[model samples]
Target chain A: MKVYRLRIAVQAISFIILIYGGLFYIDMGNRMPTFSCAYVDDRGGGCFLIGFQHMLSRPFGEFLGDAGIRLLKAMGIFALWSIVLNKAWCGWICPFGFLQDMLSKIRSFFDVDLSRFGWITRTRYKSVKYIFLVLLILIPLGIANSFFGLEKIPRDWSVPFCQICPARVILPVFNGDFSQIHIDFSSNTTMVLTTIVMVLVALFFTTAFVKRRFFCSYCPMLALLSLFDKIGLLSLKKNGQRCTRCGNCSRACPMEIREIEEEKVLTNLVTQDCTLCLRCVEVCPEDKALETRFCGIPIFTASQQGFLKRQGLDEESHTNKNGA
Target chain B: MIKTVISCFMALFCLFPALATAKAAQPATFMWLEPMSWDAIRAQRAKKKAAITKVTGGQQEAPNPAESYSTSQDKGKKRAARGARPRSYYLHSGEFPQPDRQQSGRPARMNGQYNHRAKPKKSQTQAILWVKYPDNRSLSFAPKQRGPVSLFSFPAGDGGWYDLFAYHDQGVNNDSRIHRYSYTHFMSHGDSVDKHETNGIEGPGFFKGQPILEIKRLCADDHECYRTHAGQNLRVQVSFKGEPLANQTLTLITEQGWKQSKRTDDHGKVSFLLIKELFPEKIDRRKSENYLLTTEHVLPATGVLNGQPFHHEHHIATLPLQVFPPKSDWQSKRMAYMVGSGTFLLAGGAIAIRRKRQRKAL
Candidate 1:
């Protein structure tokens, strides 16, 4: 079976559900681990980051009571959802990710060549998402509580990430709500945050033409989902002794991850940046070299015949034709 | 004889001025409900104490309501110590109307203090009903005897608009009168709660029996209808016994005592553009200002009530709404368009140039 075909179908279905499912009264709750923006008036589910930021915006002392319990419960629910499907939430469910994929498809359809980041640049940019994750946690806490005798951060900084997220401005447009496009001149903080949002939104459009899944590299959700990679139920596995290391998997990777081809000894191939798209498994030519596992059961595996069949160069058909 | 006539004329002129002043000082006779936040009440009490201190040459201090309401119980002392504001609203009469702002352009004097912990009157125990929207369930409050200013608290289990209706019917002399006061409060729990559950429902007929005269803000499927902002065209409908009350005078009173009067059309609907009185600098965005909308209807009827014949029945309805500062006061959509378009163009141009250079390098 072609994994890419199945993935595209799944992504399309997930996009419709996340974007327009509220009209059908399908509420998946607000603890989703994907970028289903809450700003959309009829959203089926909501991203957890906004609620997490709001929950963090309380006095540190208040966390000892019901506030602490509430935060724990929310985090637990978010973590459970993250662990079930792993990073499939990114490649298979996130509406923002689906949007980026569609843009990349459009660029490809126009025969536009994709650009590649330099090796040094790619390695250096790996920590960007972790930095964003850390700041997302710290900024809301600072807004509510004074740190080291300093004054509390201004109220304008509440939900700081949401104000700067490109999805907050882009996702609502699909629902015919353009109200989020305005800049709030209420305070200095709001002005700065909203300006950043505008710049990021603009960059989101331009960068998608040059790179595939550009924003996912800097997404704080990816960094969060990476924390549960070890305990996740689904995983990608590699066989070191499978003999040949063809670079087709690495060449076809959307995220430009090279460890899938380079790492020979690591049995678990689910790296921090690996979205578990199964592109690597589909492109691997050697038999039993790469496979995706769900709770110790192999769902799909790499084989020479399957790879050749997908490429329309099946040896069985060629042999039969030659014999005839 | 000329000097005596001049002196009498001067005395008569002085008496005329006194009579005019007396006429102007007549108190407001309407009974309306006012919803005050705990923070506003505290600030008012502090201001009153400061005024009292200045008047008495710093020789005396006024008693604080917080102190007066505190009990000898440890729990009560702890609550007072925490300075926890009441979650409920206060009802007050217009006799001593507390204008949000004085005629001299001073800040609003929220001087009409109502003890939120005080109970409702025993005679009018069933007069007030708290109606929750979407489900539209009318909940009854436990009765207790208290002062004229009553405290109203409801169990806001869900997030939506909770309408508190205070209905009273009394016989005065040879006529009967009905007074209905309604106040809607929006309770926001979080994003999880469905705030638009009450959007499809219309008018003030959510309950089983409608009031004799009712005034309801007309909002057609707007999710933000729970909040009324300045500079927005506010349309209100007045109905008498489930039908439109046409040609009725509806008066809108602002926090600063600015009143605008308009007559309802044949459809019993009146629209008014709420003036932008609170500017960005002077307004606290976290707090909302209260605006009172009132309309009265007089029906000619002859009825015997309490062994008295009534010639006319008067029905007065007041609806208090919380209005936020106008969006235009702080948000600039034009500036946003400029910044957003500029960023998009600049970024797109830069990306195009870089792609061209890369193509050349290849």
Candidate 2:
């Protein structure tokens, strides 16, 4: 099977095991560990569980204190997961990422071309995820401060990011539940938060259809994972001496990462914005030019033969030559 | 003859004023008797007669049905006297203001002596404050002079419908000097816990009729109310006349768990602070945080609230403390180390990536 096909299979299985596995335990003897993704909870835990849990749990930042230790313990789980899979979690396993890929396939089936951000906006948008990471950390701290009887923050400000996350409103709809879409009129603040959630959910649907992986550019999780990108085992490598300045890698890129085409040297080609989707590697025509590596081992290598086979052109070319 | 006529007219006018004053002094009268068994009422009469004889300088009067039935003993007492004792009732004459009514206007007065604002009734005395388990076992407490005191009788262990008849006639005494104010609250309380649970005790049930006010806690998490942390919003809804009340002030009291006042929005909902830190003095690590949220609507309580002819709506509901595992010292330390080291690694990785690029360029 193709790598993309294999990735879709993995995404489906993980989504089932993580999202719907709880339904199987009805009337069973022993209960299973829910180990629900901390991200599913607004106060952290899903994939990168450390951010809000640390800020919310701490009494004060001090030497050898209880709060300090708890923060460290919370980060350990994410650290372990990050080291093992790195951005492959985004590339091959994330249900949301797979959903975006599926949307792209649907758009292609309708004969619609994907839209790209202009170079000016693309460069600026690359930093958007870092901005989101900062807000993700800061907003929770503000809430922690409010809890400590500090200046009162708006009630809707609680779970500031998740309240507006498209996934919170969109993901449950796949299971035929639209309850998340309604505004919680419990308070003015909740009404405001739910309103924003609805708007973002609408924007997510429209953008994901026209622009591939539009949300990934500013995903806080992606920014968090990028903090370890240099040390991450998975990498995209480039061969500088392969000659032709063909822009195939950049043109084939879904995220429109220009660095793959702009770089003169052959180092750290896996920049922070790369989702490790390996589309660049798949499109690079030169042999031994572009490679996707796992800890320095090339898992996928680009070549003329592989590219032609992927395009379904090799057999057609052979038939044409025989007929002539 | 003219002097005699003037004197007669003045005397008649004075008599007319005297009659009007006497009529104005009479209070609106009503009575509520606890629906006690006949045997319980007879025992109560006997108890009051002994007390009244002591008060009347040992002069005993024949027991009249009105005198015998009017006196009250602790209603919380069971037939065998095994469970919690009933709270005592104090005799007050004027109408008391409802607990939840905002006190910005004229303060609600009970018997003209107590302001429900300055001297709010203790929550320990609000509503049906006790429950009996299916095995007919219950938590026991000594009888007090004030509080919502009730008896819970259970015969079958299958979580059956238990009858709870509660009534209190405040200010009902043989002493004619004080006005008698009385009211009764009734409900049949029991609903099984779930498909699996056989028998258990639950919270107090809702009042059967309107001017019915309910305080329901809408938690932020699906697990439980107390599992939610402080700073997270806990929405409490108040329904009156089967509709969500709009723009009402409710005292978001948790101080008897965490005391902070809040006003309801257009939805008759108020958000309370869910702080995990205990009040400095009340801090006990072993105990979970508990909250008692109460609100009263002071529009003469429905049915008959006489002497205290004005009804004071009092509603108190409790949410078990939403307590999660507290962060320990080691956990905090581990968090600090992870964050510090993670930052270091991130910084170091960026530098390595830069250095590798430089080496390749050279």
Candidate 3:
């Protein structure tokens, strides 16, 4: 089977497992891992990363004291996942990422060719995820400080990033649950916060349908995953000396990550932004030009003949094109 | 290779926090607080059987609270230890104290020698009842000195649980120090008393009318706080029949480790205003948001409690704070559901139309 087909099957299965894994009727003695979406604000009940973010957002004193242990446990759990899958969690496992991919597929089916942002624009947009990560941590710190008799910070500011997460709005819709899209009229703070959430939810739907993986560019989880991307087992490798600068890899990249096109290093070709989707490796036309590896063992390498075969063109058609 | 080694080391180092903070397990105590009848026992068994069959389908194991706290290895030890102890036949169910309405007549000046200003040389005092409700509302009273025991009635079928804590001094017997004892009773409204709801079990030592340190949240005018909002300034009073003597310090500690202390007034009441600020974020709220409020006061002067003489040292009580359902608006819930669904459908349709138009143009 083709790599894309395999990826699609994996994505479908992963999405099902992530979302509906809670539906099983298990006995009290037995238990299952609560593997919900990280971007979702499940009030720290599930999702290791979200729980970590929420814990860090607590007051310094509280966190340094009793909650410190809990924060460490949550962080350790998230770090464990990060070491195992790394950015594969985003490319193949994330329900929200899969949602964006489905939207892009729909866009492609309609023959809609959206313009990729310039390299500079993409580079500037990359920083937004870091900003989101910072705010996700800072807001909780504010709440925690208020808890220490510092100031009466509104409790509604509890999980700030979760209030505006596009997945919070999008993923719930798959189950016919759209309650997250409503503006909470409970308090002034809730009203303002929920209104922002509704607007962002609407904005994400429209943008993601038109522009491929638009929300992933600023996902806090992606930013967090990027921090440990260097230590991940799966990687993308580039042989810059063999490159003809054909730019096929850059064109194939949905994230518009320019580092893969620009990288000179042969070993550490997997940049922070690379999701290890291996689209770059698949599209690289030169022999031994690009490779995907697991633990320094090359799993798949790009070749001119393989690329032609993937595009449904046989050697006969290739020779005819060369003759023309 | 070194980089990878360093990363693995860092990851392992992170695991240390989890290991270091792991709490040591406490010994399991016999926890049946409410009385049970044979009918209640059969009903409980049937309930357990139904739950077990429903869960495991055919598994023989019964649902046990001890299982939730410990591993399967510790389960047998817990069961064995539990079986070894004699089952408690009854709980010291007492009358709810009433508000003071009348003044007590003074003892006819025994030879004008009993110092009114100094600590009583030999007086047998009854235990004090303190009740704390939601909205920071509290009420407390010395059952004997106060005019009458205030009859506080909770909303009988309100579907909320009320925590009834009774603290009395178990007089100094073998030990030189005064031994204080407390009972934490969780009385849920609208539920049959026979229903086996297990909180943590206290040992068999705690019983009726003994010299002990009793501290409790007072429910004002019998208004159960289960129906009020949190963060109200409530008072918690501490007292004992054995006058550990008055004017000594009593320190109150919350579950969050927040501590506040107050000296007992001449009337032997050490009342502290509990300014409820932030909710204990770490603990789960569904099972119980009961803030474990504990107080330990050392006896200042040796005094006689129920004719049993006691010396300095040892008095402590932990009152778990129970809260009522906060007021919420339910009318907006339907509107929220409608708006959310409407936006989802609208967004879906708009995207489909736009995609179709682009396809047509292609």
Candidate 4:
């Protein structure tokens, strides 16, 4: 649990710092300062790879900056993380996911339990999240001069996320100054009121009806991360022998995966949404039954059956000595 | 752990900026020899007319070619024959401005002319140009005939062949009456293939064949940079092909009454440069949008090449272009509104719908 919290905090901070440094630290004019964090200007989504804008032309072809084409390289890095952590980013570090988490919590205050519906609920809902992501990422990509023409889709689509995003609205307010930051709006409407309304409504429903993470099931960012989780590196291991009928871990699991004590596999067998939050591990009294490993290295010191057996033997020795 | 953190932090601080600065360094690598914007040129505080006059000084003057021809004719036939390159530019008046370097952008000349070092020597087959006079000073003069100009050239290697080229003095307005220069001589290389070496034989050039370069004199009336690209003339062309035959220097005599031999391009095409003229508004039924005056080098004769016998026939190509001065009128505004609004609604509406569906799904 300690490891998971520390790692999540580290990743979140690193991501913010990368953007801040790129935007605030440099002042070279006319020179595109390398893969821009100015999500507003997607030279080419692949611009990440090129590092700079190169004016390339042929007898004929579409021309774009390297920004977006650069992000395609992110897939390889994403796959490496998946091999280790699954969709842990979506569940934990993703600011968008985190926003939805806050919303669901607000809902809990209103008594809404979102996780009541099971897999049998409906298959139609599954397509919604993917559809949203395609609209957000791809449609703008296809049009030469559509509305998504020049700006980012994230700030506009993730209304709730941006509304409370500390990087944009809150950080400047808290910092007491905003002369350095420059934000270009892609959407036409003001967000402060809209975000308030949505958050309030979310809070009302969260307490009244649905599960805390229900909105996440349809989150585009989670959906993308899930694709990475398919080949993750870190995994949860379960020992079958010492397993009792304790449903404690499963009940505490956030994404509602079934296997806590018995559902162990050689690899990560849960959904890509496994956050590595270790809430299940913390709840399990017999921690020896479950273990966390990275590429087979003991990341979390697990209490195994062998160690417990040794302890039991040591106790017997002590009692005998005392009685004798 | 501290060391590792320090190294990571150092890498973080240094790496991205290094990568960024490295690419930024490239723009500095290639120095821009030419000015990028008009503001830059304007900021140079260059006087338009003075700069242009230097490029054209007395180069286009024909010394009153008609007067010289008249004097020779009256002075007896011997002197008339000596007046070989007489040109009558008195016909062009008020249509163009006085030649000045500042008014018209000047072509960058290394010594005096871009092709002066590349000039070939004299030969019989080569069309040797003799400029009788190099300055013309008439803003408006009426000409009896507005027809094609003749050009001449010779074999490239043996000397005596020179390609004819013309450039308008920059900064000048649409008045083309400025005297135009003409060169009447050059040499010819035996083979048509390989002429890039002809320039005063400058260290054996990389290519071959004397190319017939079509120097189009774009007048300032053009939309892009009428000020920069166009000077006074609308067009100028050079060609040496035909029924009369491209003699030494690929010269041809125009049957449309022009007796001077004209040079033809390697592809047997004629070259011309013209400052596209603003045509009379289309108010009249015959309103010309633009007047593009162009002329094709009509082949005077042809039979066979290398053994294939084939007869050829021809006609002179056009020299004048139709110019439609973009008029700011009610009809134009109406058309813009019709097209612009329709397109905006259709394109924008489709985008909005696609977005709505996507948002709902999300």
Instruction: Highest TM-score: give the candidate number.
Output: 1
Q: Give per-residue CA lDDT, model 1, range B40-61, as digits (tens).
A: 6658757887898889977874
Quote the lDDT for A86 in model 1.
92
Residue-by-residue lDDT tens digits, candidate 4, B1-362? 99999999999888999888865652100000011223433343245445555778836532312233322112332232231222221111111111111222233222222233343322111111221111110011111222122222111111122222222211111221111222222222111122332232111101122212222332322232222112222323343321222222222211111122345444433433323233333222122222223222223344443344434322222222222233331013343334334544554455457657867999
TM-scores for all predictions: 0.78, 0.49, 0.52, 0.33
lDDT of each residue in A1-324, candidate 3, tens digit only: 567677777888767656654455312110111224433322122444445555566445444333565556556667767766778777776677777788888878988656467778887788998998898887777764664456846557777777777666667666555546565655677776766666566656667777777887887778888877888787777888888888898888878887777777656765667677777777777898898778889899998889888888897889899999
Tell me the tens digit of each residue's lDDT in model 4 across A129-167: 677556544433432223434543332323232232222
Off by over 4 Å in 2: A24-45, A49-64, A146-152, A184-189, A315-324, B1-362
Best by lDDT: 1
Off by over 4 Å in 1: A316-324, B1-88, B95-97, B100-161, B167-178, B191-213, B237-249, B256-258, B261-270, B278-288, B299-313, B355-362
Error of 3 at A294 (Å): 1.1
The true-versus-predicted C-alpha distance at residue A185 of model 1, in Å, is: 1.1
Please state the i-RMS of candidate 3. 10.1
Give lDDT: candidate 3, residue B346: 81
Q: Find the candidate with the highest DockQ and give its number.
A: 1
Rate residue B37 of model 1 by lDDT.
Answer: 67
Supply candidate 2's per-residue lDDT for A221: 77
Q: DockQ numbers for every candidate? A: 0.40, 0.02, 0.05, 0.00
